[model samples]
Target: MTAHLITGAGSGIGAAVSARLAERGDELWLLARDAGRARELENRFPVARTIVGDLAAPDKLSWALSHQELPDRLDSLLHIAGVVELGEVGELTPKAWNLQLAANLVAPAELTRLMLPGLRAARGQVIFVNSGAGLHAGAQWAAYAASKHGLKALADALRLEEHDNGVRVTSVYPGRTATPMQVKVHQQEGKEYDASRWIDPESVATTILAALDLPRDAEITDVSVRPGR
Candidate 1:
């Protein structure tokens, strides 16, 4: 069985992806910041392992990575941990900007680097759940856009670097989705952001799974899934 490691598996798209992978009987390591939620998922799935770590903290992430004992090398690494900060350039604080960078770009890069050896051994895939905002800029989304753009660059670079090792990297840019992060952004902006009109989390998960199921001869470099209507 292929082993899959997922971050931010406690809620939203992360949770949905974990559930889908478990349903397929793939071995899973659910990494999240909340221990209670991780335990709940473990109880429900009964076939998944849990690791509690805040991706924003390098030391904590490194510690968790060192302590994890997987039965086999990881065949896939799905990075779903990201944060969005909504504010104009003048209103953005240094702390908020740094937090966005830490969670969205730096942490994912570090995690991928730390796990590269195992992925190489298994000829695995690296999946990045990015945002449409990363492709097109928006007003008052400077920090979020910058972080995601950086993540896109990192993924592209890694893909080129690891191509010789037989590791494929897929970066998925999803449009507005019905998730807590969308709701939070709507609340913060006080705008009537109709998330129901956007793509749902399950559909995004399906796209990700499809990429994972592709033959090793073919690789989907990047994919963007937006709402139909």
Candidate 2:
């Protein structure tokens, strides 16, 4: 069975991806900020193992991983955990900027580094669930955009560095989805939360799964999914 580690496996796109993988009979390691959420996934899918850690806490993350008996080889590493802090550059606070960077960029990069040994052993695939903001920043999305842009760069660099190791890195840029995060963004912007206006999380998850289904010799470097308005 394919072994995969998925961060932010609690909800939204992460949850969708986890469920899909479970149905495919893949072995899963679900990492989430909320242990309860991870447990919920495990309850439904007996093939899942749970790891709870605050990604912002580097020491805690390392400790948690060290304590676990992770798979000896990992087929896929899905970096789906992330946070968004929205504001124009002038209005962005230091805390907001730092949090966004830590969660969206630093955490995933560190986790990838930690899993590199296992990934290399299996010639694994690494997928980053990025944002359209990574490609272009808007007026009030400075911090989020910057963080996602950094994530894109990280994926690009990792792909080039790991090519000789037979590892594939894919960066998936999905447009705004009907997730809790998007609801929060709508509220913050004083706009109504409309699911119809956004792409479905399952749709994005399907795209990721399709990429994973490609032949071993084929690699999908990047995918951009947007809702048609």
Candidate 3:
């Protein structure tokens, strides 16, 4: 059976992807910071395992993976954890800035590095849940944009480095999805954000799974999914 590891599986796109994989009979390891939410997902998907740890903390992430007793090899590693802190250039505090980087960039990169042996052993794929912000800059998105851009770079570099090892890397740039994170950002801004008109979580998950199903001889380096009118 194919084994897949997904981070930030507690909600949003992560949760959707997990559900899809489970339905396909794939063994899944779901990682999230909220134990309660993870447990909820575990209950929903009896065959899935949950790992509760804050991805923003390097030590915590390391401990979770080391002690969780995962399979010897993984077919796919999905880096879906991310944070969007809306702040202008000078408005970002040091703590908040670091946290954004940790959650969005550092943690994903570290987790992939730690799992390289398993992925390479299986000739697996690494999928990054990047954003359109990573590809194009916008106002009042300094921290989020920087982290996503770094993630894109990381994925690109990993693809080249792992090419000889037969491990593929794919980055999915999703435009404005209707997720809790988007809702929270709208609430924080005290403005009406029309998320219903945006891309749905299931669509993004479908796109990701499609990328994962590509032939081993081919590599879908980058994919951009956007909502249509």
Candidate 4:
């Protein structure tokens, strides 16, 4: 069975992807903020292990992964943990901007750095869960957009740097998925939450699985998924 480490595995696209992988009998190491939710996955899948903590803090993240006794080499590292703080440039504070950068960009970079050797050993894949916000800036999405764009840049850099090492890096941009984060974004806009209008998290997870399923000789450098109107 393939061994994979997934962050933000408690809910949303993270949880959906975990479920899909379970069906295929993958060994999973799940990192989530909620211990309860992570443990729930352990109950559902015999191959699942739980690591509960804040992914944004390198120390906490490192501690959790170390304590969990993960496989020495991972087949894939799926980074799905992120924070979205929406605000116009003028309204955005240093704290808000920095938090978004740390969680959405820096955290993933740090985790990937820590996991690089194992990924290299296994010739593994790294998938960054980015957003359409990375591609275009909206009236009140400057901070979030900036962070995601940085994530895209990070992925590109990693892909080039690790290509010779046989590690594949992919950045996936999903547009307005129907996740709890979207509910928060909608509430900030004072708009009624409409789940039907947004892309399903499972849809995004399926795309990720596709990227992971590719032949060793083939690489999908980038993927963009948007809901049908």
Say which candidate scores most in lDDT: 2
Provide the lDDT at 47 for model 2: 81
Tens digit of per-residue lDDT, candidate 2, span 1-229: 8999998777789989999999889999888676677678788667899877677765467777887778889999998878886777889999998899988998898889889999999999999999999899999999999999999999999999999999999999999998989998998898989899999999999999988888988999989999977
Candidate 4 lDDT over 1-229, as tens digits, reads 6889998776789989999998888888887666777677677666788767675575567766676665689899999988887777888899998888888888888889878988999999999999998888899998889999999999999999999999999999999999999999999998999999999999999999999999998999998999996
RMSD in Å for candidate 2, one decimal?
1.3
Instruction: Evaluate all candidate structures by whole-model CA lDDT and list the values in order.
Output: 0.88, 0.89, 0.88, 0.87
**Greater-lDDT candidate between 2 and 3:** 2
Encode model 3's per-residue lDDT on 18-126: one tens digit a residue.
8899988999988768778777878877899877767789656777778777667989999987888887787889888899899999999888888899999999999
User: Over the stretch 21-131, how does candidate 1's per-residue lDDT look in tens digits?
Assistant: 988789998776767877787886689988776777855787776776643588999999789889999999999999999999988998888888889999999999999
TM-score of each: 0.95, 0.95, 0.95, 0.93
Question: Roughly what TM-score does model 4 have, to 2 decimal places?
Answer: 0.93
Provide the lowest-lDDT 10-residue window in model 1.
63-72
Off by over 4 Å in 4: 34-37, 43-46
Total backbone collisions, model 2: 0
Q: Candidate 4 — what's its lDDT?
A: 0.87
lDDT of 3: 0.88
